[model samples]
Target: MNEQQENKPLISLQNVTKTYGEKTVVDDLSLDISEGEFVTILGESGCGKSTLLKIINGLITPESGSVSVNGQKIATPAPAESKLVKLRRDIGYAVQGSVLFPHLDVAQNIGFVLTLDKKSKPEIAEAVERARKIAGVEKELLTRLPGQLSGGQAQRVGIARSIAARPKLLLMDEPFGAVDEITRRSLQDELSRIVKQEALTCLFVTHDTAEALKLGSKVLILKTGKIEQYDTPEKITQQPATPYVNTLVNR
Candidate 1:
C-alpha cells in the first residue's frame, strides 16, 4: 500500500465499461496510472486491454464511466480544441503492423507530424533529424522507401514518427511483434531507456508475460474487461492474484 502511493498518477479511469453485442470486453474497469510510469496491460487474445487503450486515447468511446487525465475530465472522443487538442498532440500511439506510407521514406514519415504542427521548415528538419537519431535510424535508410526497409527498421521508423509529436503519454500495442528476437530485445532496451529518459507515461499492451514483465513498472492482468490483478512485475510474479495469473507467468 505504501509502495503504491509513491508515484502521482496522471490518469485515472473510474467505472469504465465497454460492451459489443452480448459480449462485455471490459466491464466496470478502473485504473490509475502514475505520471512518468510504464504500466503494461497483459492478457489473453480476447481480453479488452487493447480496446481500453483506444478508449483512453478517445479513438473509441466507452459505454459508461469516465477517464480523467491530470484532473481534467476527458470528454469522449475529446473535443479537438485547446487543451484537448494539445493533449492529443501530447499523446503518442503506436501499434504493430502499423501502416507506413508506401510512398514515403524514414525522413518523410517523421516529418509528417511536424508539418501538421505548422512548425518552421528548419524546426521540422531538426525534429526529424533528432527523432531519427533517437531511433538509431540510418541516414541511408532515410532515403529508402518503406518497402525497402526490413521489419525491424520499419518498426523503428514507426517509433521515431510517434515520438516526433512530443506526446506526453505513449500507448503501444505489441510494438515489437513483427521484429525478430534479437532485434526485439535491442528495441526493448532502447525503448526502456528512451521512456525513462523522457519521463514518459506509457501504457503498453501485450499478450506475452515476458514482454509485460520486462517493460512494466506496473503490470495489470485483465480478464475480459476487468483487471484481475494489478501490481509491480515482481509482485505479480511472486504473488499472483489468481491461479490463471500464476499459470500465465509460469507458462
Candidate 2:
C-alpha cells in the first residue's frame, strides 16, 4: 500500500441507501476511501454504479444513512445548492460520455470550471495548459470546438477539464466507453498517469472487468445495489468473496 493509504479516508459512506419510486438503487452501502486511492466500481446494468457516484458527489441524496467527504458532512435527503456547489468545488465529475459544450472551444471547455470558480484569465490559462499537458492533449487542438473533434479527443478534453481546477477527488463514469479499443487504451494510460502524478483520489465506475482490474488500487464489485466484494484487484482475482465475484473475474 502507498503512504496515502495510511492516511484517513477522504470519503465515507455509512449505511447509505437511495430509492427511486419504490426501487432501491443503492441499498445500505457503506464504504471508505483513502486519500489518493484509485477505486474502480464494477457491476452489471442496474447494479447502481452511477447512483453510488452521484451520492458521493451529493448530486443524488440517499434516502437513508450519511455521507462525508474531506471531513465535511454532506446533507442527505436533500443537499442545498450552495453546499453542493461548495462541496463539488473540490470534486470533478466526468460523466460516461464526452460532455463538453458544443459552443465552447477545447480551451474554453477545459477552463470552464476555473471560470466558474472566478479565476483570473492568466490563472485559467496556466491551469489549462498544465491540465492539457498532463492529459496528453496536443496544443494544436486547444482552439477546436467539441463538434470538430473525434470522440477520443473530446474525452481527453473532458478529462483535462476535470483536472484543470486541481480538484482533490475525481469521479469518472466509463470515461473510455465510447471510444475504439486503441483509443480506450490510450485514455486509460493517460488517466493512470495523471491520477498518479496529481495524487488525486478517484472513484471510477465502469462495466469493463479488465479496466476495473487494471487501474484500481481497490476494486469494488456490486450486485443488485449491494457490495459483492471490495478488495485489491489481486485479492479479488485470487479469492473472490462470492460466486458473483468469481464468475466476474473468470468471465
Candidate 3:
C-alpha cells in the first residue's frame, strides 16, 4: 500500500456475505477503500455489483460479516436507524435511469434533500447552483420538470440532486447507461471533472469495461460473487488475473 492508502480506510468490508434464498450474492467479500479514491466495480450482470453498492450505502443488509464507512460500524441484518440515517445523509447514491421526482422541477429536485432538512433558502440555492455547475445543468432547465427533459438532461438533474448535499462519498451504479453513446461520453467527462475537482471518494459500478478503465483509480473485478482482481486500471489492463478478466479486457 502507498502512503495515501496507508492513511486508514474510508470504507471497509470484512468477510461480508449476502444471500437471497439459496443463491449467495456476495461471498465472503472483504475490501478497503481509501479516502478520495475513485474505485470502480466492474463485473458481468448479476455478479453482485449493485448489491455491494447498496450494502455500503445502508440500503441493504448482508446476511453475515461487517461493513464500516467513515469509521462507523455498519450493522448487518438491520443497521441502527439513527446511525443509518446520519450515514445516508453523508453519502450520495446515483443509480441508473432518471430518478427525479415527477412533480418537481430540476432545481427543486436538486435541492430536495436540503429542503427536507429545512435548510435556509439561500443555502439550498447555493448548493443547487454548485450542483448545477457540476452536473452541467443549464439555468433554463431548472424550471423544467422531469417529463419535459431528455434522458441525458434528466440524468444530469439526477446527478445534480445526488451531489447537492456535498456528501463524503458517492456511489454510482450505471448512472449513464440509459443515455446515447455521445451523451454517455459527455456525462462521463463531466462527472470525471466534477468528482476530481471536488476530491470525492467514489465507488462506481459499471458493466462497460472501457468506462471502468477510463474512470477508475482502481478497478475491482467480480465473478460469481467473488473478487477476481483488485488493482489499478493500468495493471488490470496489462495483467488480468483470470481468463475471464483477460477476455473482458481484450474485448
Q: What TM-scores do the predictions have? A: 0.91, 0.94, 0.94
lDDT of 3 at 36: 83
lDDT of each: 0.82, 0.88, 0.87
Model 2 TM-score, 2 decimals: 0.94
Better of 1 and 2 by lDDT: 2
lDDT of 1 by residue, 1-251 (tens): 47655565678898988899999988998888888889998999989888988887766678888888776677554555576656676555333336678998778887887887899999988988888888788888888889999988898888888777666788888788877999999888888987887677888889989999999999989997888899999999999899989999976
Candidate achieving higher TM-score, 2 or 3: 2
Model 2 lDDT per residue over 79-175, tens place: 6888688667755443433588899999999999889889999999999999999887899999999999998889889999988888888898877
The list of candidate 1 runs beyond 4 A from truth reads: 1-7, 76-86, 90-97
Model 3 deviation from native, Cα RMSD in Å: 2.1
Where in model 3 is the C-alpha error above 4 Å?
Answer: 1-6, 90-97
Better of 1 and 3 by TM-score: 3
Please give, for residues 1-251, the per-residue lDDT of candidate 3 as tens digits. 78865689989999999999999999999999988899999999999999998888887899899998877877565768776776676554433335789999989999998897799999999999999998889999999989999988998898889888887788898888889999999888888887898888888999999999999999999987899999999999899999999999876
Best by TM-score: 2
